[model samples]
Target: MVYQGNDPKSNDNYRAVFGASSAPFVTLLEELPDEKRNLRYSLFCDNLFTSFHLLAHFKQLGYEVTDTMRENRIPKNCPIAMKKKNRGSRIFIRP
Candidate 1:
């Protein structure tokens, strides 16, 4: 989806994509319906969006989010493997 600077309500762009240097998910989340914003939902996002900040933001926005992380985004001491022996297991650490 493209970011429409002057008209955010629509994803259509006149030409160029102009937006704040923000997580792409942040821009997408901003378009949520007001009431649904407070409802809990399971969200699946790409690796580019998997970060502590995004996780916290998703939680605050009432989402149970799932995503894989790049090693650097994780703290050195935290072992993601030990937390899960297989897929679908999640560890939520409060920032």
Candidate 2:
């Protein structure tokens, strides 16, 4: 997907490639604009894409990475580990 700016002079190119899995995502990234291509950006993906290589690439590009561990599926990697943590039914964190 691309977001077009209002003015031609202020226009920027943005692209998003959706895939069934991150394995393909990595492959797709190889085809995208690289840091040497003079582009600065970030990545927003699901937990299925939370891998060391992926993070490294985004970090190299000076891009902030955001990935949620829980989104109706099991997470492959979690920055915030859920292991040994208790899951209560009626507890919510929003204050």
- Give the top-scoring candidate (TM-score): 1
Local accuracy of candidate 1 as per-residue lDDT tens digits, 1-95: 56454444444331223222334457666667888666777887666657666677677766887677766677776655644356665666553
Q: Residue by residue across 1-95, what tens digits does model 2's lDDT show?
A: 33232333321222132223444554445556655444665667767656545565667756666665443454456444455567732222221
Q: Which whole-number lDDT from 0 to 100 does residue 32 have in model 2?
A: 64
TM-score of each candidate structure, all chains considered together: 0.57, 0.42
Where model 2 places Cα greater than 4 Å from the true spot, the runs are 1-20, 33-37, 70-95
Candidate 1 minimal-lDDT segment of 10 residues: 13-22
Displacement of the residue 25 alpha carbon in candidate 1, Å: 0.8
Candidate 2 clash pair list: none
